[model samples]
Target: MRADARENYEHLLAAAHEAIAEHGAEASLRDIARRAGVGLGTLYRHFPTREALLEVLLRTRLDQLTQNAGELETGSPPGAALVSWFLQAVAFVRTYNGVVALMAAAIEDPESALHASCETVRSAGTRLLVRAQAEGTARADIDGTDLFALIGALGWVGDQPTFSPRAGRLADLVLGAILTPGEG
Candidate 1:
């Protein structure tokens, strides 16, 4: 791509990121293009669909969470590491309005653009869960996919417009159930 075209692409991505952060995954593409001083066609040329744009916007965060899982594996006790990573996953899934729902769908739909990102997140959580289980810190019956589902559920709770303060308590409750006695 030419330097100017590359610059336009970067600008559109930046604007889309900010718009999505503020308005959520359903934020208007046209608004994003306007914010970036680009035409809607430019945004579409760079990101053919809403899911494609969302994938790019959220890819860095998904990678960060994956990297954090690796760090937590060795940096903390197994139980503590798993708990920390679970909290981060909760945050990641709740990054935007309806994101938890989007992730839930993505996990089930192989054709979804966000499916790979969801898989990466689940793999990271799975590693933490397996380590914790091996160390007798987490419940043996629960697997990574289950944990991912729970994280999405927690994120859904957090995303409620009514703003329930019970979100934290709910997280604690789920964590308590997942962890073995006297762990987490």
Candidate 2:
């Protein structure tokens, strides 16, 4: 890319990040372009779709989560690692205003722009869950899909104005249920 084109791309990403943080996954494309001081055509040229833009914006964080899972697996006990990673996953889904729904959808749709990243994060969590279950620290009935659903539920709680304050407590309750008795 040319210097000016790269600059515009960077500006669009910065603006989209801010807009998505403030407004959500549904934030207007036109508004983001306006905030970036770029035309709508330029934004489209850089990111053909909202999901495409989101995929780029969220890729780094998702990669970090994946890496964190590997580190936690080696550094922490099975139960503690699962709990820590689960909490961090919840926090990540709640970062952008309405990302919970987007992630939930993306995980289910293989063709979605965010599917690969979401799947990687889910698989990482699954590894932690499997380790914990093998150690008899976590419930054996649940699996990776269940864990991903719980993360989405907790993230959704954080998104709600009325229930947001109780998200942490709710997460604790969910974790309590997932961990075996005398564990966690």
Candidate 3:
């Protein structure tokens, strides 16, 4: 990309990040363009769709989570690493309101732009889960799919206006259940 085009791309991403942070993941693209001082066409030319834009916005954070999962898997005890990474995954899903739902859908839809990102995040969690199971720290019956669904449930609870404060406690409960007697 040319210098000016690159600047516009950066600005648009910054503006969209702020807009999503303030207005949830489904924030208006037009408003994001306006905030970025760019035309709607420019935003479309760069992102093409809301999902596309969101995929880009979430890529960096998801990548970080994947890397963090790898580090934690090697640096900590199996159960401790899984718990720590599970908490981080919860926080990652809470980056924008309603993102958890989108990610959940994306994980099952191969055509979705965010599918790869979702898969990467899931794979990281799965690795931690497998490690825990192998070490007899986490329940063998509870697979990565179960853990992913649990995270989504936690995210949904956190999204609710009245029940948001209890999300953390709920996550802790889930994690506690996943761990064996001497692991948590």
lDDT of 3 at 180: 82
Candidate that scores best on lDDT: 2
Off by over 4 Å in 1: none
TM-score of the candidate numbered 1? 0.93
Worst 10 residues of 3 by lDDT: 175-184
Indicate whether candidate 1 or candidate 2 has the larger lDDT. Answer: 2
Candidate 2, residue 151: how far the Cα is off, in Å:
0.1
**In model 2, where do residues sit more than 4 Å from their true spots?**
none
Error of 2 at 128 (Å): 0.4
Runs of candidate 3 exceeding 4 Å displacement = none
As a whole number from 0 to 100, the lDDT of residue 118 in candidate 2 is 94
Model 3, position 31: C-alpha lDDT score? 98
Ranking the candidates on lDDT from highest down gives 2, 3, 1
Among residues 3 or more apart in sequence or in different chains, the pairs in candidate 1 whose N, CA or C atoms overlap within 3 Å are none
lDDT of the candidates, in the order given: 0.89, 0.94, 0.91
